[model samples]
Target: MNDKKSVLRSSFLINFAIGLLIFFAFTIGLTTKVYIGGGIELYGTFLLALLILALNSPYVKHLSILSKNQALVLILIAWVLINNAELGRGIYERLMFTLFFFLVYLFISEYNEWTGFCLNSIKVLGIVYAMLTVFFALNTGLYVNIVMPVFADYTSIYQQNYAFLNGYLCGFTPNAAINAIYILAALGVCFSNVIVSNRRKVTSWILPFFLLGILFMTGKRGHLIFCLIALVLVYFINSSEDIINKYSKFVLITFGLVIVFIIAVQYIPALANVFTKFENQTEMGRIDSGRFDIWNYAFGSFLKSPLWGHGWDSFKYLFEPVYGYQINVHNVYIQLLTDVGLLGAIPFYCFFIMSFKHVKKAFKFYKNSTDLKAKRDICFALYIQVFFLLYCLTGNPLYDATPLFLYIISCAIGEYYYSTRNKT
Candidate 1:
C-alpha cells in the first residue's frame, strides 16, 4: 500500500509541475494586460510560495548547493564590482538583468530537477503559439489592412493580401520567428535521444512543415539563414549514432520538397508580387545601420572602463546614443564585452566551453555505463543543453526564464550522473 501511494504522489507532482511550466512558457513573453491594474505581483506571490517550499526540502537544499555553479557566482561578483566602481551606466543595466536571470536558474536547480517538464512544456507551447499567431495573422490580413500601430515606424498600413494566401503570419512579437528557432533547437535535442523514437519520428514529419509555415509567414530572412546554418552544422558534425544523423537524409529531402511546393504555389501571379518581397531588405535597416554605430560606441566606453564595464544594460544612456536610445546589444558576445569586461566574461566563456566538452564526453560514456536509465538520462540532459548553447548565439536565451530553467536542469543532471559514477 505504501509503495503504491508513493508512486501516485510522484506521478501527481510530475503532472502538476508540467502544467505549471507550460503556463509560464506561453505567458512569460507576452505583454498583454492579462494581469490588469498592476496585478503582476500575483506571479511574484506564487514564486515566493515555491521558494518557501524549496527552502524546506532537503533534496532542494542538496541540489542547490553545488560547486559547479561557481562560474555563475563570478558573474554576480563582477556585476557588483562594476556597479560599485560607477564606471558606466550600460554596465549597470546589463548586470542587473543578468543577475536576475542567474538567480532564477539557481533557484530552480536548487529546488529540484525541473528540466524535463520545463523543456517539454516549452516545445508544446511554442508550437501552439506559432499556429495560433499564423491563423490570426492570415485572417487579419484578409479583413483589414493589418495596420500594426505599435510599430508604426517599422510597419505601415500596408496591404497583406499575399500574407493571408501564403499562410505566413504572427502577432505582437511578430510571426513566430523566435518561437520557430526555439522549437528547432528543441527538435535537434529531442531527435538526438535514443529513447522517444516514435515521438521523434512524428516531430520529424511535422516540423519541416512548421518550418515552411514560419518562413512564409514572417518573411524574416534571419530565421531562414539560421535554419540553413543549423542544417549544415547537423549534417557535417553530427555522429552517425546521433539521432540527427539517422534522419539527416530524410530531413534534407523534405526540405527540398518544401521548396518545390513553395515554387508551385508561386505560379499564381498574385503570389509573385508577395514572393518578390523576399528580395527587399528595408526591415533590416535599423539593425544593420545600428551595428557599426553601436560597436563604435561600445568600444570607446569599454576602453574607459576596461576592468568592469559601463554598468550592466546601461549602454545607451551612459554611452551617448550613437544611433538611438540604448536597449539591448542583440548579440551575446558584444553584449558580454560591454556589460562584463574580459575579467568577468572569461569565466563564463570557460564554463560554457568546459561544460560542452564535459557533456560530449558524458554522452560517449553512456555506452559503458551499467545502468541504462542513468546513461540515457545523462545523454538526454547533455545533448539538450548543447542545443540551447548553439541556439543562444542568435538570441540571448540565457537572459530569460526558459533559459534559466534549462541551466538548472543541466546542473542537476550533471551532478546526478557524476555522483552516481563516483559511488560505483
Candidate 2:
C-alpha cells in the first residue's frame, strides 16, 4: 500500500542503466551464444538486467522491493530448476531471465519519468536498425564477395549461403523474427512520439511508416500484420477524430490495406500463396508452417505434466524426435504451457498483467495529457506491451534477448507510471 522511494537517482546513473539496454539491443546481431555451467546462459541483455538490479539492490538494503504477491514470480523460476529432466541451457536461462527481469523491474519502475529517455534510446536504435537492415538487405552480395572469402572461418554455412539474403532482413541478428520485434518496438516508440506530441512535426508522421516498411520487408507475417493493426488501433484509441483529422484519411487507407491483406491471405489464392509459401515450404502442400502439428504435440506434452509442465524448452525434446530438428514452438503461450505447465506459467505471466494494468492506469490518467514527453512514454509503453502480448500467439519474440529486454523495459515504465500516478 505504501509507495517506495526510488533507490536509484534519475541523473547519470539512470542514463547508465538505460545505456545498458541500448548496448544490449545493438549487440543482438554481434553476440555469440554461450552457455554457462548448470544450464544457465549469461547473455548481454540478461547480464545488463542483473547489473542494473545489483546497482540498485544495496541502495534499498532492508526495504522489501516487491509487493507481497509480486514476489511469487520467483517461485516459478525455482520450480523450473527442481526437475533436472526439464533443466537445460534453455530452461535455466529462462529461470535466470525471469529472476533478473523482475528484480530489475522493481528497481527501474521507481523511475517512471526516466522512460522518455529509454524511448529516445530506442529511437536511436530503431533508426540505426533501419540502416543496418537496409545495408544488410541490400548487401548480401558484399558478404559473398568479401566476407565469405576473407572471413571464411567466421561465416557459418548459413551465412555463407547466397540464398540467405533472399529471405527476411535480419538486421543485426541471425534471426529475422527477433529483428522484426525490435523494428516493431522502434516503430511503436517513434509513432507514439508523433501521435502524442503537442507540436506539429511533419517528419514524425513519416518515420513510423519508414519503420513499417522496414518491418514489412522482414517477411515476418505476424509482426507486420500486428504492427499495421496496432497503428490503426492507436490512432483511433489514443486520438480524437479532430486530433487526427489530417491523418485520418491516410490511416483509413492504411487500415483498408491491412483489411485487404487479411482477406487476401485467406480468400485470394495469389496473395494467400505469398503468405503460405514458406509455411508450405517446410510442409509440402500444407499451410500454417507446420505449427499446427507442433502446437498439438507440445500441447499433448503439457497434458502429461499439467501441473509443473515438462520444463523450459520441453517442446524441443518432445517434437525434435518426431520432426528431426528443433525449431521454436512459435506460440509462446503454448510453449509456456508445454514447458512450465499451468502452475509455473501463472507466476511468469503475472508481471505482464500487472505492468499492463499500470499502463492502462497511466493511459486513463493522461488521456488528455498535453506533455509530449508523458504521452509518448505512456503510449509507447502501452503500444509495445500490447504487441508483445499478442505476438506470443503465433510468434516467439520472448525467446530472444533483444525483444524480451525491450518488452520488459516498456512494461516496467508502465509500472512506474502506476506507482507515481496518485502523487502527480
Candidate 3:
C-alpha cells in the first residue's frame, strides 16, 4: 500500500510540473500563437491527467464522481447520429475533448492525496496569471504595438471591440471571455483558500483582490459579476467559527475592499474606464450588449428540438450571419439544450446535479471540519463549483476546453474531499 501510494504521488507531481511548463509556454506568449482553438495548455493538462491515470492502471475502485458522466459520451453520439444532424469536425473534436477531460477527471479522482496540492497550485497560478493580466490590461497599447508581434493579426479586432473601454485585458489568451471563465474559476479557488484558511496571510487576502482587479479591466461583465457573487458566498459559508469571524468579519472586509477599489477607481484611469463603459452601456439601455438577443435566438432554437439539442454547435452555420462569427450560445445550459436537446442533455445535467450534491455536502461538512486541509480543499472545490454555476448564467465555458476541464476538475476535487469527510 505504501509503495503504491508513493508511485501514484510520483506520477501526479511529475505531470503537474509538466503542466506548469505548458501553462507558461502558451500563456506568456504575446498571443497564444501556438494555441489553436483548443488551448495547448489544456491539452497538456488533460493529457498529463491521462498519464497519471495510465501510470496508476490497477484500480481497486471506480470513481463514484464519474458514475453519472458514464453516459455522457454515449448520449452525445446517439443524439447526433439519431438526429442525422451535421456534426461538424470542430464540434466533434471539442466534444471528444470534453469526453477525455471528463474521463481523466473520473480516473484520477480516487487518488485524493493531490487535492490539497492542487489547491495550492491554483492559488499560486491564479496570482501569477492575475498579475500578468493586470499588467497587460494597463499596457495594452505598448504590448500590441511594440512587444508581442503575434497579436498583430487581432490588433484591429481588439481595438475595434474595446474602443469603449480599456483594451481587452486578456490579449494573450485564446478568447477574452473564455480566459475570464477559468481565471474566475481560479479566483474562486484562491478566494476559498483565504476565507477558509486556519492560518491567513497578507498574500492570501491580496491574491483574490488582485485577480478581481484584473478581471474588471478585462470588461467581461458576466465573469466580473458572478465572480463577486462567488466571493460573497465564500465569505459567508457556514464554518466552525463564531458568527463575527465567519460572517461579520467577512462582510466588513468585503465592504472595505469595495470601498477601497471605489476610491482607487477615482484615481486609476484603467479601473475608471471599466466603470465608465458599464455606465455608458447602461445609459444606452444595452447593458447586455446583444447577449439577450443571442440567448433568445438559442433558446427558441432549442425549442425546435426540445428533446435533444439541434446538435453540438448547431449554431455555427446559422449564427455567423446573425451574430457575426460567434459560435456559442454564450450560455452552457442553453447550449446543451440547443446542442443535444433535452433528452441528450440528461447526462450532462446529471453530472452537474451530482457535483452539486457533493458540493452541498462539502459545505455542510466544512462547517464542522476540524481538519484544516480538508476544510480548505473542500471550500476551494465549493467556490470553483459556485463560479461555474453562476458563470454559466452568461458565459459559454463548456464550449471551451480549458474552462471545461477546470470546471470538471473542481467537481472531482469536491467529490473526493466530500467523500473523505463522510468516511471520517
Judged by lDDT, which candidate is best? 2
Each prediction's whole-model lDDT (CA): 0.50, 0.67, 0.64
Identify the superior model by lDDT, candidate 1 or candidate 3: 3
Candidate 2: tens digits of C-alpha lDDT, residues 99-151? 56656665676665457667777777777877777787668776456534543
Off by over 4 Å in 3: 1-9, 12-14, 17-51, 54-87, 90-93, 137-141, 146-149, 152-168, 201-203, 241-251, 321-324
**lDDT score, candidate 3, position 310:** 68
TM-score winner: 3
lDDT of 3 by residue, 1-424 (tens): 9999987677667457435433532353332455554455556655665665545533324323334443553464455456534444433445556556666565545555656555556556656666666666667675555534554454454543454244556645534564565467567777766766667888766767766777777667777777777666766674557776776777787789789988988876566545766887899999887778888888888888788566666766657787667567778888788778888777777777778787778778767667766676667666767778877877777766556666766777666666566677
Candidates in order, TM-scores: namely: 0.69, 0.80, 0.82
Q: Write the per-residue lDDT of candidate 1 for residues 1-424, one digit (tens) a residue.
A: 9999965665455446445544543454342333343334435534543454345444455653454554465465556554543343223322433343444444443333344555556556556655655555556753344334433343333423344344445444322444444445344344334342323454555654554454444554444455545444433343435666556866887689768767866652322322444444345555443555656666677777776766545555655445544345545556566766766566667667655665555555554555555554555556555555655554555555455445545655554454345455
What ordering of candidates by TM-score runs from best to worst? 3, 2, 1
After superposition, the stretches of candidate 1 with alpha carbons farther than 4 Å from their true spots are: 1-22, 28-32, 37-46, 49-65, 70-101, 107-113, 141-168, 172-177, 181-204, 227-278, 282-289, 367-395, 400-424
Q: What is the C-alpha RMSD of each candidate to the true structure, in Å?
A: 6.0, 6.0, 4.2
Candidates 2 and 3 compared by lDDT, better number: 2
Residue 135 displacement in candidate 2 (angstroms): 2.1
